[model samples]
Structures are given as structure tokens and as C-alpha cells.
Target: MLQLNGCAAGSSSLRLAKDIAENNRGARVLVACVELTIVAFRGPEEDYLHTLVGQASFGDGAGAVIVGADAGVHYPAERPLFEMVSASQTVVPGTDHVLTMRITEAGLDGHILRRELVPVAAENVERCLSDAFGQLGVGVEWNDLFWTVHPGLRAILDHIDKALRLEPGKLAASRTVLREYGNMLGATIIFVLDEQRRRMEEDGEGGEWGVMMGFGPGFTIETMVLHATSNLRKK
Candidate 1:
């Protein structure tokens, strides 16, 4: 059996990581840190904030997934909600400081979000899709099951929906996540995917398709496509 912890730093990731690592020492454990370039709201003299934008130029978060080869944990033998077909990432140079978040005594905080980022996002999203799909020799069409895009903000979702020419309800899942979880950095997309899987399991339906996407510093975007399986629907 494998246990996975998708938590951010100084929050839950550390304790979860320690518990899993100590107990499942021999399992294939993976730890990933996702850093975002967050613009701090403090009067703009913060060095850490500048370092984040000037050096890393990215907001950051972390997630860990463990797969046990010999442990007797039973993951149902149903078709996966989505088989991760392919993934692509692109970095737009010279666009640092566009988005950012910061940690403080109060808590994590950041900008109020501007509407203009939407137009910038719309122009780049298609290229991301094209590259990701092209690698797999697949073309996108309306019949695709779901569009699991990152919901950085309400405006961003509106921009992406408009740019992609998505259907009215295409981004509902993403929107719901935003309303509930705020932007969880890299973890946001994964949360949406997990929810989609949960919804299918609860409804006893499957064989769906979905796309997952995330954007980060360097003004970069990451994308992946998944094909769900009915066999995996929960009982």
C-alpha cells in the first residue's frame, strides 16, 4: 500500500512526508517542490519578494506521491480516471514578477489580481495545448470529455474559456476549486483532477477524458491529458 501527501511547505507537507517516509522506507517515494513567483503586497521593499521575482521569479508549493510495489494496499483494478497521455511545459522569458505570493506572520498573501493578465494568458494557452497535443499526435475537439484548466483567478478562467472557445460549463470544475481552495499553486490542478475522479466515483460513471494545466513563474505553463476508465469507478 502506498500513501501520498499533497501538502505545501510549513503547512502539512513536512509532517506527512516524515510519517510516510519513516513507515514506508522501501517504497518508491517521490517529493516535488513547486515554487511560484509571488508579488508581495508590502510596500515593494521586501528582499525576499525581490529575490523570488529576480532570482527564482516564481511562486512555490510542494506535493509528494508514493507508489508501493510490494505493499498489500489494494488500489481497485478499475480503469484509471485518466491515463496521463503526455505533458508539455513552456517558459516565456522576461516576464518575471507577473504573479506572486508571499509568506508573513499573518499568513500567505498576494496581489488582488488584475484583469489584464487574462489577455496575456489567452495568447499563450493555445501554444501550450498545441505543443502538448502535437507530441501525442492528437487534436483537440469539442467532443473531448473535460477541460481541467488551472483557475488562477476568476478573470483568468474567463479569459481561458473565451480563448479556447470552450462550452458554457467546460470550466465549472476549475471554478469550483478556485472558489473553495484559492490558488494552491502547482497543487491546484491536481486538486481539480482528484475532484473530477471523486465525482465520477460517486456517480458510478467512467470512460471520461480530461485535460489538466498549470501556470507558474517564467510565465510558464504545463499541460497534460488524461483518459478515464469506467472500471475504476468506486463501488
Candidate 2:
């Protein structure tokens, strides 16, 4: 079983699942993400802010998706949602302390340098998206694509919105997921994806092209380009 940790885990699984499915004909990969932040909870710590933030923001959650090629042929009843086009992972330089978690004798310990998180993400995300799309030999406008950004913090989302000059409601799904479920760690992205699917199907709120972004400790970022298929919208 392939395993990963932190917020970027779900996106990383998507990338790996796509590779496995495409490489092995008829192979289906099931990617499951589960996080129990309670396990890491510590009582009465010196870093009260850290503990409080963790308690306030982190939650236990799980999400799963089946990835495969030749969807109609291999799984006739299964309707495909988003088509994974391309994916890339990038680490922001010299900002590893922005968000971090580790296993210690005291169980789990972590820190969130709240002030640095938003600014660093805002500064680097535009270039990161550009580089990712540039590698595909295409130019994409930020506003034209649907976004499923990891809701690490409301401020982070706001900074990204301002930085990218995104249109209103582009990040509604992410925000909604955060409000409803807090941060489910890596599994949070799946909730955001499902919410996006609902919006697309029910409201026709987004376009054909989309981007899924996940951020985690080490200031790690995961970007995946997605194409909405017919199943994503109602006929």
C-alpha cells in the first residue's frame, strides 16, 4: 500500500494512481486518504498557539477515489468525473518552517508559522502555476480555470485570490469544504474535489479546464491539471 502524509498526500496519490493506471493496462488503483489529527493532539503545551491552531483546524477524515484508464471498457457502470491531465510537485525555498509536523517522544508535534504561510504561498504560486502550464507547452490564464486549492487557512486562500486575480467564486468549493469539515489533512482535497463536482453538475459554475492544488509541510505544493468530462455535468 502506498502511503503519504500531510496535505499534499491526496494530490500525490492522484499523480501516482494516474501513472500506475496508464502504465499497466486494465489496472485499477484505489487511492485512499485518511487523517486523524486527534492522534497528534497534545495537552497543555508551551506552544499554546500551535496546540490551539491544531485543535481548531485539524479534524479526522477519510476519502477515496478509484483511478483507471479506459473507463468505459474496464468499468462500464462507473462514470468518470475529472480527467487528470498532468501533475507537478514543487517545494518553496527556505520556508520549510512555515508548516511542519513531526513524531516525537511526546507523540506528535508541529508548528505553523501563520504569518509566513500566506505571504510565501502568494509570492510563489503564480510562478509555480506558470511553470507547470509552461511545461505543457500552453499558456493558461488563472481566471479561466476552475480551482480546487487546499484550504490550509482562510488567509492563504485570500492571499492566493488576490495574487492570482481570480474571479469571484472560483474557490468556493475549497472554502465550503473548509467551513464544513475543517482541514482533513490530505483527505481535504478529496472533499474539495467532490464539492467542485457538485457545483459543476448542479450549477454549471466552472469551465472545462481546472487546477487542483494541495499544500503541506515543507511548504510543499502539488498541482494537477484536470479536464472535466461529461460525467462532471448533467445532460
Candidate 3:
């Protein structure tokens, strides 16, 4: 397990790489990105254009997980939450600049709810999902834990739910995190995982499973399946 922050605009990818190098050192790291794209554009044409322009200027952020021979430390009496059985990523070309966040006079503003996002996302989600599950050599039905996806926005969550046809509470954690924290770019997934860990501790559940997914520029989507040990501390 690892922790990261993607606060700085456009530097997430590089920052993740740097963090992995400095902290995880020589451990193998898994990288994932989530990119937003348009499913459609409506409303006042000018407003839509402004939104698109804002998203286009957005920069990439990075996040990583170090996995290797290091057994590391342990938490007393707690079971592992989830094991990262597998991870994968996919890129939807020619759809770049569809979703983004930019530094504005007010602050960082995110533009992710495009009309085209739904359809475009729906078309690509299955392949990505299949790839992720396939890499792990297991089926999605095998999952017994939570899905800690990067909730780009309310509409994005709706689209994802529709695309994946998840159950009612399937994305509750992700949705709650998004509503509370907005999108924290690369750090969003970590936040969700952290929350999951917290929930498990509170519930005294052992051997929990979780999946972290995020989308970023380049119209990319990254997914990782993780298992948590009960021994993790509140941190």
C-alpha cells in the first residue's frame, strides 16, 4: 500500500513516478489514470465551449502502488483488507480533452460532466472492465468487497453506474467520497481506499476486498483490485 497527493495541476503522472522512486524505492509500482471525455454537449453553446476550454488545459496527475518482495510491517489483530490481485488500464484515442480540470483565477475548477461522456464511456467501459478482470484471471462476480472508483462528478458516477450496471450500494463509497471531497485527482482513489480501510475497522471486518479506479487525461482509465489487511492502523 502507498499514499499520494495530486494537488498540483498537470503534474500528477510525474509526481507519482517521483514519489514511487523516492519512497517505494525499487519496488514494482502500478500506475493508473482516469480521463474524462464528452458524451454530449448541451445548454448555452458558449457556456459549453467555456467548459470544454477549461477542461482542455487540464494536466495529468499520477498515482502508484508499490508491490514486491517486501513483507513490510503489520498491524496487531487486524486482517489484510484486500490483496491487489490484478491491475489494468485502457486509452480511448481521439477523445482527448473531453474532460479536464484547470487552475483558474478563483482556484482549480473541474469540468467533467459532458453530455458525450455517457455514451463514449459506455462503449469503452466493458472492454476496460474485461481487461481488468481478465488480467487477474478472475471474474467480476468474484469480487466481494467495495469499489473505490474516482467519482469525477455526480453525472460521471451515474454514467459509470449505468455502464457497469452495478447494484444499488455497489458504488456508495465512491459516491460518498466524491460528494464530500470533490475530485482529488490522483489522490482520490487513495482517499477512497483509506475510507474503506476505516469502514472495515469500524465494522471489525477482516479480509476485505476493494477495487480502485480512476480516469484522467489522454482519455485513460486505470483500475486496480486490492485486498486490505485488518491489521492496518487508522492512518
Q: Rate the local accuracy (lDDT) of all candidates.
A: 0.55, 0.85, 0.55
| Global Cα lDDT for candidate 2 | 0.85
Per-residue C-alpha lDDT of model 3 across residues 1-235, encoded as one tens digit per residue: 2222222212234334434544664454455544232222233354344555544433333333443322344323323345555556566887766655455444444454468655666677667767776776765452354676766656767777777776676777777777676665565666566666666678643335556677665566666656565464334
lDDT of 2 by residue, 61-138 (tens): 999999989888977898889999898888988988888877656667678888988899888888888888888887
The model with the greatest lDDT is 2
Which structure is stronger by TM-score: 2 or 3? 2
TM agreement with the true structure for every prediction: 0.62, 0.93, 0.62
Q: What tens digits encode model 1's per-residue C-alpha lDDT throughout 1-235?
A: 2111111221123223434545675544454545442433334345334433332322344444442333333444423245555555566665545544455563344432255456667788888777767777876673355766767767888888888788787777788877776666556665666666666677543335566677654455666666565444444
Off by over 4 Å in 2: 1-4, 45-49, 233-235
- When superposed on Cα atoms, how far off is each prediction in RMSD? 8.3, 1.9, 8.1
Give the range of the ten consecutive residues with the poorest summed lDDT in model 2. 44-53
